[model samples]
Target chain A: MEEFEPKIVAFCCHFCAYSAADLAGSMRLQYAPNIRIVEMPCSGTIDHRVLLKALEDGADGVFVAGCMEGDCHFLKGNYRAKRRVSHVKDLLRAIGLEPERLEMYNLSAAMGPRFAEIANEMTARVKGLGPSPFRKQTGGDA
Target chain B: MIVAEQKPLAEIAGMIGDCRKVLFAGCAGCVTVCLSGGEKETEVMATALRMKRQLEGNPLETVTYTATRQCDPEYVDAMADVVKGVDAVVSLACGVGPQYLAARYPDLWVIPAQNTTFAGGSKEHGVWEEFCGLCGQCVLHLTGGICPVIRCSKSILNGPCGGSQYGKCEIGKDVECAWHLIYERLKRLDRLDLMRQYREPKDWSKARDGGPRKVTREDVMIG
Candidate 1:
């Protein structure tokens, strides 16, 4: 049997998580290659539709990475993203999709190791859940 | 504004059952302001329904559109071309939206995705309470801006009923007694004299009991 490689899309705030990914690369940290990071001005910019669009477009899993609570450069952008992510998770569960497929993480730009850890963690979680039912049923290109 | 809530996911999914393609219509009016149905909510419902049907081994194709106001003929007419191609339409507006769409496109199946709850406004973020009953009569002036028609459990016009206990209604602990609210408001404004005036029974003909109603203004009518 061929090994399953999950497709994960991570929306990272440019102020924090995105910079952390760059630092991870410079440090030569090992992480899952399945992650595709899309940088946003702030995680708050990621609307529920954008998150669902990623899944609809074939992503097996999705997550938003932002600054720690009360530490957002925009004062409350990360908090807003957190609430939106939670709402999307409920919507996914209602649709019969596993809520675990979506998540939100808080971290600072200096946490290169933590960035790699999250990438690996999310990849492992999605792999265990297997391919998204969307891809399996629709033969969607993700 | 009209306050509404989305129907449960199971109920909505059942309504659209066995359909291959459907149009999800949203209203950018009162429903939007109340967070029940709008462009954002329309997309959310579309995505949810698509995934749900996909899971059932019956994939669904959804096209989404938000009219400026579904109650208006002009806004509903704007979807004529889109409605022509779909098997059904799921309207996420107040009750009026689905009715308007159904009247406009009699050939298409029109389903309501929300339950029209009341005529009210947001009391706070994510919280809404019933305010007006649309009785076609204005009595706020006598009631100190508190509406007994909606807030009171019995819709009493005279005074608090025997069921009022400790400023709360007998219907629910969370419900504040409307008469109590009126009393406090009137006392604060030094308008206690207004309460002494006996109000006659409301005219039922002005409300829904009169059957379907319409308003035509001679000045505004144009050929």
Candidate 2:
């Protein structure tokens, strides 16, 4: 049987993480293909519900990749995203979910290597955790 | 407007524990202004529920919808499509919205996300207090705009009770003595005589004690 590969959703900031992924493509950086990228004008546009929908849709893990601290193209966008991510973590934990499933990272658009690095890191972390129980195949539906 | 406070998250989570397909219904009315329920909150709750279910190995199906005013029938009717296949409806409006939903959708299980508090205004950002006691009597003008009925811990109409000291109430030092506020305002207006006027004891019969209140404006009636 093939080992379960975790599905991960990455919200990439248009100004940074998205561009960094593009840069990674140009650099031919080999990384895990398990991560799906959703491009947003800014991390601030990543609402709490979107994150929840991804998890409900069976994503094993979620991440927000935004500009480095104090460097958001839309000033303070990353900061706002950080706060929202933390709040979501609390809400998740309160509901019996591992807060670690949701994460926020700050990096510049030029950091292609970092993007691959995080992609590899998250994929491994999720793999160790096994498949998401929410997946339709897991018999998790009530 | 009807005001409300968000129900504790733990409590809400427990209520929806067995639900799979759920509709998070939020009201864009008083609860929205108070930050208890709104479009953003509706989404937040749906996400939380989804994540929780996934973690528990009992994944849930959740959707979010916001009504213009859940207390209104027409607005609530808009949720028909969203609630179509859901097993339950979690309402984020005040006390009125859940009752309205339950009444309209007798077949659907309805739950409340907020605890109806009172008819009040936000004293400041994120802080709300009871302002109108719904006494059915307007006495604010006589008290220099400070409502003694709701602000005063004792609801004393004559003046500040002996418990007042240094401009605070005895019930709690942090509480600003409502009558002290009245006195200061009256003094500023140089209307000290207003406090000297003897007022009769309140008639509770005409207030909320009379049962569910009703107000009819003849001129405003279409018929």
RMSD of each: 2.2, 4.4
Q: What TM-score fits each model?
A: 0.93, 0.77
DockQ of candidate 1 (2 decimals): 0.66
- For model 2, what is the error of residue B35's alpha carbon versus the real structure, in angstroms, after optimal superposition? 3.6
Docking class of 2: medium
lDDT of 2 by residue, B57-171 (tens): 7878888888999877889888788889888999999989989999888898999998899988888876787888888887898899999998898888998999999999998
How would you encode candidate 2's per-residue C-alpha lDDT over A54-142 as one tens digit per residue?
A: 77778889999999998999999999899889988887778866678889998898899999999999999888877766666744322
> Best by lDDT, which number?
1
The local lDDT score (0 to 100) that residue A15 gets in candidate 1 is: 92
Provide fnat values for all models in the order shown.
0.60, 0.83
Off by more than 4 A, model 2? A1-4, A16-34, A67-75, A108-121, A136-142, B16-23, B50-65, B73-88, B103-109, B122-130, B158-177, B180-199
Cα lDDT, model 2, residue A102: 85
